[model samples]
Target: MSAEPTAETLSRPPTTSGEAVAVHGVTRRFGDVVALDDVSLDVGPGEIVGLLGPNGAGKSTLLSLVSGQRRPDTGTVRLFGGDPRDARSRTRLGVTPQETGLPPTLRVGEVADFVGGHFPDPVPTPELLEQFGLTDLARKQTGALSGGQKRRLAIALSLVGRPRVVLLDEPTTGLDVSARQALWDAIRQYHAGGGTVLLTSHYLEEVQALARRVVVIDRGAVRADDSLDAVLRRVALRRVVLTAPADLSTWAGVVRSRPVDGAPPERQELFTPDADVLVRDLVVSDVEFRDLEIRGASLEEAFAEMVAPESTPESTPESSPSIEGAVR
Candidate 1:
């Protein structure tokens, strides 16, 4: 067997291609379990694409193929117009897996230096550390850092090579809101410099904040791939929240309803395709309500709808079909 590719081997000169990533008719499986099935996608240079899916939905599997950690059972995966498995093709690619292992005895700065040493042109260690709020922790040992700090450090290390494309898998999993926002800014700054990113996140707001394009996968297949706005617009459900004396789950046009947890017993949330018609009908029926709120469906709601088993053509917006309450 051949030796595993080292960081230096994967840090060759960058490619000047227009497309940063391309995967076509790909399928991957682990024994009898299919992780990705007949998937195809292309990402252009400088684009920030969000890959969203529930746990075990093949998000990681797809990333593995593009990053050359695993091969597709069929079809091709490319980075900068070359085969992804080739070390030269991965030269411009940086990646942070969901879990990263660091040398326990190495200081933070040392770790960054070690990774940066593999590339011909690396971001200065100090500058890279400062960009991710890790300057103060430079002397800390990897084993001693907090979970959030370690997460930040891992992401910072990915950029040390000045890679043209970065793959982040749940990049902000352990971060607080402020740290998460800081990382977002760092990612934006990198993208401003023409870096491309393909990230997977469980945080809907994270995707909303950073990604112009969204790709959603479920059951090892691509369910939706489109611009952020287009994907949200595909969800016809509108959200309506109000406080009422009686249950409104049976209301005409309500596709789903559930009580707002932790709120007053009378507070309820409902989803309908046409909020205007629902509100007018509530007024016509003289139903007493207060604190009424109506808004477009959120990304969470849109995701829930798209992944629902009944979201097919047979269940149009006009159909009074019900689904489990939208993901909170």
Candidate 2:
């Protein structure tokens, strides 16, 4: 960094500010379309939360409200016990949007140090660069970096201020496997240092690896909010892949079954509530099977079940609390 890091620039935000985030009955709309419907969530101080959802599931909209980029049509959003819209509240906040516009001409180190200058106390540019695995690219211009490097720098920029609460929107979107893991490690270190984080992602592995507390959202509403294990248990569907000669669609506990397209028509997939029960049924019926494999359903399947229109008869904002209450 061209700017020298001084003692005055190494300060940190107060860490005991109770709840770092509080959203109550937030509603936002664009024209006639409701982007968010009376959604409310809380993230305590020093907690890491991942808002998991598919594209356009209101994940970005909710993060926008929390970061004060946009206001909710109705309801409130608080950060560190103050209105997020207020400058004072935002001073303690650091945010990375779904996409960031970096000055192409500026070097990576220069951009970081410049942003750090805006805060009362900021992390040292070199230290921040080391944390995000960007130290090697410090002299490189922002526009010359690869997509993954740019993403890593975007997230690193959010932490330059050493803010108490950090909000990240789709932090690893479009990143490669290695770059994503490197960014995840940086985020983990930030959380390890007691920095409260609220991030949104459509990647299941991203949420699964980073967040202990997850809030699943779909179609502009909260579907499930709980521990990762509890969320997985709630959608406990097993996927059984095998080569079965007899039809498995009629098996007990089978949610859905379909034949996989391949040579000899032997491959098939059986989605069931209990793979053991289905296997027992198969054994009792003398059905021939081969290459059998039983595994837990993917997050995509769980998300599908959560958002499936036929699964829930009630899809109104008024019923949200009751459903959430039931989950708790």
Candidate 3:
């Protein structure tokens, strides 16, 4: 490991206003196909920002550009106030790309040792392996590890540096629920130790669980950026599942309702945020509720709605989406 500035030197906290990572008016094109278009966003130090989008939405392109693996055709990108290609930037950042870059024939420990050499004050190789639950697999070739093991090993390589900023591109791809939970725990610990994390994931649940804020991109542009709660509230979808005692005839503003096709034929309800008022109206209509369950808008629904084709018009007016809801 390379020598590092001591805690006293690094103790000056980053400014809340100045971005830890910034992308301004960024644009990238490959033979006229725009991968990114005039996009701008920032990540604050010690924040976990979820970068989200559908397939071909340019999430990977944005990450690659920031990591210096690929450069933008137009606009500026800065990491801790410097170009990503700068030596300081490279040393301060850790990246786990979607594709595993490890050599198949290399032993797990060897790979960690190699990557660890690039950082200042690298974690001990043995400790790194243990931290990622790869200690038993240390002597095994990378090729022999199972998919989940390989992914975990890849994460270990990135963490060897104890980087200030971490770019995790789909960090939980192959893991089962338990393994994913373990990874989330580790990431939380990283943040607690003062690391900033930027993640791109197809799993909405994962983002909701892990990210404090989220940025949704679609069609090469930013669609939404705000706190996770804000995105869900903006979508404003409501689900009301209930069993009714009466026939429950038509009620105004009730979007859709159907009898669940079970032996009991309980009712399943779907509606918007207007359901609160509609429920009041239901009393006048003499509807009886035997059982009722209400669920607020979910991140999955918000993400789908934001990236849906029809929401394209909403993307232009705001650089990023804003939310006004409290974190639950």
Best by lDDT: 1
Q: Model 1 misses residue 324 by how many Å?
A: 5.7
Per-residue lDDT tens digits for candidate 3, residues 123-228, read 9999998888899999999888887887787677767888888899888876899888888888777776767889988667777777878888877899889998
After superposition, the stretches of candidate 3 with alpha carbons farther than 4 Å from their true spots are 1-12, 15-17, 235-304, 307-328
**Backbone clashes per model, in order?**
0, 0, 2
Give the per-residue lDDT of model 2 (tens digit) for 72-135. Answer: 9998898978888877788878887333488889999999989899899999999989988899
Q: By TM-score, is 2 or 3 better?
A: 2
Best by TM-score: 2
Candidate 2's displacement at residue 128, Å, is: 1.6
lDDT of 1 by residue, 97-153 (tens): 344588889999999998888788998999999888889999999889888888888
Residue 4's lDDT within candidate 2 is 17
Residue 155, candidate 2: how far off, in angstroms?
A: 1.7
Identify the runs in model 1 with alpha carbons over 4 angstroms from their true place.
1-17, 97-100, 235-269, 273-277, 287-302, 308-328
**Candidate number with the higher lDDT (1 or 2):** 1
Where does candidate 1 clash, by residue pair? none
